[model samples]
Each structure stands twice: as structure tokens, then as C-alpha cells.
Target: MSAQLIYDLVPLGSTLVYTDGSPRPPERHRKKLAVWETRNSGGRLIRKQAEARVGNTVLPASITLHKGDYGNQGTIVLRVHQTFSVNSDLKFAVKERPAIGSVLVLARPGDDAELVHLAANRADAEEWLTRHGYPRAVFREITADTVAADAVEGRAAA
Candidate 1:
């Protein structure tokens, strides 16, 4: 379904939720995380910077939200990579979703080991949602060039 790509952020640890409506945990228990993204004018999803899911109990849990048009359908979403310390249940309420593009799912659900679902290619993405049990996932094409640019910029700054 080239409708919308949902790069849902799946932050690991119980700190994602606190005693109140806090989106982040206290600084002592919090780890730095970032969700960098970019897309073409056609609304194709692109990965600007996605950190590796490393370290003990570290999870890159944030989505790069975007929007796009898919034939007669339209969607809004982003690219997401996540890792969990252990099997845990979580909740996320995105005020918005992707318009349509690439859904490069870079994380694995610790609880559901069989739920590794993500797609490339526009047509394949449409089928991905139907077959892989993904909701509103629309994958577009993202080449290494997209990320190469990011590296160059980083090097130049350094």
C-alpha cells in the first residue's frame, strides 16, 4: 500500500514512559537518540542518518516523518530503526503518519521474533503491508547515494 510509511520509534527500556506524560525519561536514565531523515520531492523516503543499534540495552527508537503520493493514494510516514534491551510491551501515539515512500524497517521486535517486516521498491512495499502485516507502510527506493551525502557533509565539518 503506497499510502503512508510509518517509521515508528520504539525506544527501549521502561524509561520511555514515566509517572506522568513525559516523552523522555530523566537525564540520569536517558540515552541520547536521534532520528535524521530526508526525502525527494516526489515523497520518496530516504535515510539521512541511522545509528547502529549497539551497546547494552540501546535502541534507536525515533521515526523520520514524511509525506508522499502513491498513484491514487497518498501517505505520510518515515524511516525507523529500533533495538530493545529485552522483550517488552510499548505504546506510541503519532499525531501524524507518513504520506508514502520507503519503509526501511531497521529494527527487530524482541517480543515477536517473527515480525521483521520492511520493504523496498514501490510495488514491493505495497505488497509488503499486505503480506508482512504492516499497516500504512509504503516503501520507495533509497540508494546509498542518499546516505553518502551525509557522510561527506560530516567529513567536511570534521
Candidate 2:
């Protein structure tokens, strides 16, 4: 699937994988394997930024994926995020979608809201909110209606 399709159809917090259609290189070829991993890895959808005009330049619409987090013990030091423009050439596939009844913890309420976390239930969401400070976070529950709509629209996860 195309990146645009992902931005339009796949809900935030869904797991997605993008690949260059190449076989994985052997571990012995460290450099080549590292490069291959960059082009072929899975991540959770986090943000979708719409196209915007800033002075003389027009920014393209893009989707951001949370690739990984680096930390020690319970402290997170670095977060790896990959943003792909809708025109990206890499092949993308929706690996998994947030299940119905799950709650999406958005950064805020708006078209530009980013998914901060996906909780299994409202109770879990509240527990997470207490630990993570997102004063403006909004909770959105995944429903069967939404899933049905996606299917009706031919946006089934591959």
C-alpha cells in the first residue's frame, strides 16, 4: 500500500511496515544489514502531518512512525521516529490495527492530533494519563463502526 493510503485509511497507533522489497542481508555483512534494516522495519503509526504552506515553501503531507526507543532501566533517552512523505517510494503494509474497545490517547483534539498511546481500555488509558503528563490529551475509543467503515472503504489491513 502507498503511504498516502496509510495516512488516509490506517488509524493512528496501528503497526505498519515499510520495505524496499529486498531480501535481508546476512549478519556477517554488518554494514549492508544495517542499511537494509533502515529500509525494512516495522513501527507504530504515531503522527500524520498535513500539507502546509510556510511562506514560500509548501510542506508535503507526511506520516510518522515510532520506530524504537532507547533507554536504560526506566528512563528513555532517545526515540527513533521515521517520517515518510506521501510520495515515498518504499512499499508500505498495515501490519496491525488497534482492536475495537481499545482507547487511543491523542495528544490533543484536532486533525493534527498525534497518537501518544494505545490502551486496552478506558481504565488503562486513565492509568497511563496519570503516569504520562498530556494535559491536552484526548481519548478516542476504537469502535466496530469505525472498523466496518474501513472495510467498506476497502482499507482492510494487509
For lDDT, the strongest prediction is 2
TM-score per model over all chains:
0.25, 0.93
lDDT of 2 by residue, 91-133 (tens): 9998888899999999999999998889999999999999999
Q: State the lDDT of candidate 1 residue by residue for 1-158, as single tens digits.
A: 01111232221110121012224434454232111111111122223233345766555432232233234344424434333212223322323223224344423333222223334445665565565554433333345443233234223111
Pairs of residues clashing in candidate 2: none
Query: Which candidate ranks first by TM-score, i.e. highest?
Result: 2
Cα RMSD to native, each candidate?
Answer: 18.2, 1.5
Candidate 2 regions exceeding 4 Å error are 152-157
Candidate 1 residue runs with Cα over 4 Å from true position: 1-120, 156-158
